[model samples]
Target: MTLDNQHWERISAYLSGDLSQDERNAFESWLQDSDSNRLLFQEARLVWESSRIKLRVKNPATEEELLKLRARIKSQQPAGRIIPLFRNSALLKIAASLTLVTVAAYFYWTLRDTETVIASGDQVLTLYLPDSSRVWLNTNSTLSYTEDFTKENRTVTLKGEAYFQVKRDTAHTFEVVTPATTAVVLGTSFNVNDADSATIVTVAEGKVRFAERDAAREKDVVLTPREQATFHHRKKTMDRSRSRDMKFAAWRRYKNVQYEKEVKNSGLYLATQYTWRKNQINQSVIEGTIRNSASLAVYRDIVLYVTYSQPGGPQKTSRLVIGETVNPGQTIDYRRRLLDIFTETNVLHVKVESAEVETGDHY
Candidate 1:
């Protein structure tokens, strides 16, 4: 399970949510190929989280400098003998300093570490902990665990917002540390939000012990499913109440409902023309016209579901994003070019999946 530079690059891309659907599927298949692959990926992920360094080098060594370094390395070897670049650590380091290869080497060297995971920008990250616990981090959130993680203790510090599903380990208690509050449980699923002026803990399943981070155990409030506890930041006080609704977890549920509504209401028709150029690298070109039939709605960021298959083979679907705006009763034309399409592929199907409607102020 010794990963090469290319594997490391793919792992990095997967972590950053930069891989396309096809690449993601391939990487996931590779990950499931063996347990060692999964472990190596997890180790690299830890390093990635701990370093928090952008893989890009600000100032890279020039070509002449790289050549000189290589020449020096060759001079140290015996006559008529050459060492592989990967076999020599010194050469690897020298080359890493010169190019993007540094990212792979850096992670490889420190693969045994990190205790923090952050979900930045609009990325929502799902993490599988060492103890097999699950955590879903919302945007702009941070979660850090102790070095002993699942060994001697199961504790994690959280900032911003995160949802946790702790595995049942009767011998050890799971704990989540927020700025003002601490949530302790043997096994439970809960949401913790520390981003606002008050820290909020909402229990979705099982039970949790909620208290001030530094308060005595006597002050702890026991919360069951559908219960919530709020710790005020300024007043340093705690409030417990029964949750009548699931507003606390709305952030996790809103996206699906919104997307489904958009897809259901989208009144866009798609007509496609396919062309295969056998002489030019097996290029496949699809020209499509999208017509908006809605009378009052304007759409943008249209997502198209495309199905293609080789003759007598199973169909495969992929998504294409079109950012062009189409007004009510308007038609827009788009062309997509794909290279190296299978020579036997003769079927192409396209349809609008979803689109963002412009409602001016509100929808």
Candidate 2:
């Protein structure tokens, strides 16, 4: 595709890692939309890097060839005879100008598309797009975009959950793509969570155009602030309602504003200590006791994800249910054996996953 100057600037920003989360995600979505965009991005990157490669160390064979060229030049000319080519400085300047123009045109044509992918594994990540828009990706989430982002339309593909604070761009509309739904807006802040059970879209600020992802006969609705919509995958239905609780986007807000508070009061922090012992069969056994620190009883299953890492070696992470229906102030024990041949586990990152508050009575 023939891209304009705007596309070039976007690609430049992407290469410099200056794209915001929304822009980055949008650009990657454009990239996935076509293989040609991807190939163009790759070629542009190679060309951009090739310019720097010129400054690197030269091959010995190249130096030898240069010496041979110099020797041939010296032998071809008569003694004390000035070269005709060097005598015409005007011709030399014209040749230099033509060469510069050729290289610039080549780059302008080749480097028009770019792609970016961001993944938040255990912790949340905040990023800015080329247009200075901001987006925050939740844990275990991914976002992607392409160079054409914001140039024509601001679009993004998201997996899992994300909180977006898009910059105002009246000329172009911002859109978020998920497997279940597509959210369209113009400079608005919203929260999108696409989980196995359902895809939830909550408008924290401004309005959002939420639509189903069906190719044929798509359905859409406008969601106002404090309103949330749920697209149930199993039911193949979309439900919209005014949120009963004001914390419709509490999960995203918690990660952004009260992460430290959540960490301090969470169940993982309530585990006062841990014990590790080697069994008779040479397997390492890890043990820890977690307590329900929150006031609400945890009726749903709470899993503790632990990452085992050794110095200068690959890391392995595994999840196990620490407890189910842990009442307030109740404690539960966790024990697991390491089957890998790792001599010692040096680094351990423990966090709670899949935690839910029990609404009904849990005796």
Candidate 3:
């Protein structure tokens, strides 16, 4: 196989680990084009290793001494005996010059094809993709994609964390490729975080396909709006759950709010009543009442946590949410039957999560 100066330069930079993210991806694509390409890279790398030593000025001598050494070596060769090209010191100097040129050209060429944005402080950088997608790079994060992103596909390689507002393109899929996972979507908004050993993907709008990569178990998880999935590297598993924190990506606006705990005795009022069912001693009924005390209407979430001590074993706890909305001064009554014979009647805890302020008119 034959390679021009540009290809040789790229191989050299790749061997040196100097290629940018986009350039590395492009070089990998080139390497996969054919078997001959791989062989060429291997051969070029070997040649590079051997030639680097020759390129160095191990022993510096004055111009007169160098000329004397060159002429003396030429005279020692047998008459009519052909000397190889590299044995000639002048040819070696030319080859070293070409090597230096290749290194310089590689840096210049890679800079032209890739664009990088880095957020090094307590601020975010807004970037526009070739397809018009918007990205907010978090502090100490980086986002690198092709300068001509929309030509074939829209792909961005991220390090650290970033929130993306991708433009919709049904023809081309928008992809965020990280070290641990790859998220693919047509057009959506999401936040991706590389958490050392795992990758967390939170979907804010639309749907996304979160696929695990560079892990033991390959899995594909679909995340809907207000959903999150964490890909764990050690376990090689993907865990999906409802995302309670909506302001996870709000750091870009500096408006993130971590909820505060309300006083345990305020806001929600709980009452419980028990009854025996059909004169059966083992079965009983427990009636519960929850009242909203706030004057303004709010959405209330209630969790009934029950703890029971298993015989000769450890204690266990289970919780069930009372999914309902209550208006101001409204009361909702619920009935809970104690069907479990082993559950202690008095070992229960009622927890009321803070009520969210209702939006829209209450009328």
Per-candidate alpha-carbon RMSD to the true structure: 21.8, 21.1, 20.0
Kindly report the root-mean-square deviation of model 3 from the true structure over all alpha carbons.
20.0
lDDT, candidate 3, 1-363, per-residue tens: 334444554566666666567666766776666555655564454233322111222232344433443343334333332112122243233334445344433434444445444553556666677788877777777676654468767877787888887889999999887765789999998899987889999998889999875322245788999899998878878899999886777565432111111223333444333332322565345566777654233455556655544346565655656667765457887766545565444444444444444443332
Ranking of predictions according to lDDT = 1, 2, 3
In model 1, residue pairs whose N, Cα or C atoms come closer than 3 Å (at least 3 residues apart or on different chains), thus clashing, are none
Q: Which stretches in model 3 have alpha-carbon errors above 4 Å?
A: 1-108, 111-113, 214-218, 255-363
1-363, model 2: which lDDT tens digit per residue? 433333444555555566567656766775665555664454444344322111221332354533442343234333332112123243333334333223333343433335567788877776787787778788899887766676766877788998888888888888888866789888887889999989999887799988776323246889988789998888888899986665544454334433444434465434535666667775667787667664223435666676777788888888766545665557777677766454565666666655555545221
User: Each prediction's Cα lDDT score?
Assistant: 0.65, 0.62, 0.60
Highest TM-score model number: 3
Candidate 3 positional error at 168, Å:
0.4
| Deviation from native of the Cα of residue 243 in model 1, angstroms | 0.4
TM-score of 1: 0.41
Off by over 4 Å in 2: 1-113, 214-218, 253-363
Relative to the unseen true structure, what is the C-alpha lDDT of residue 19 in candidate 3, on a scale of 0 to 100? 57
* Candidate 1 lDDT, 1-363, residue by residue in tens: 334444455566666566567656766776666555655565565445433321232322444533443343334333331112123243333333333344544443433354444544466666678898877777777777745677777977787888887899999999988766789999988899896789988998899999986566799999998998889988888899998765566464233333344346884333334343334556566677878755235678888777777778887777878889876457888877654355555777777788886644211
lDDT measured at residue 184 in model 1 versus the true structure, 0 to 100 = 95
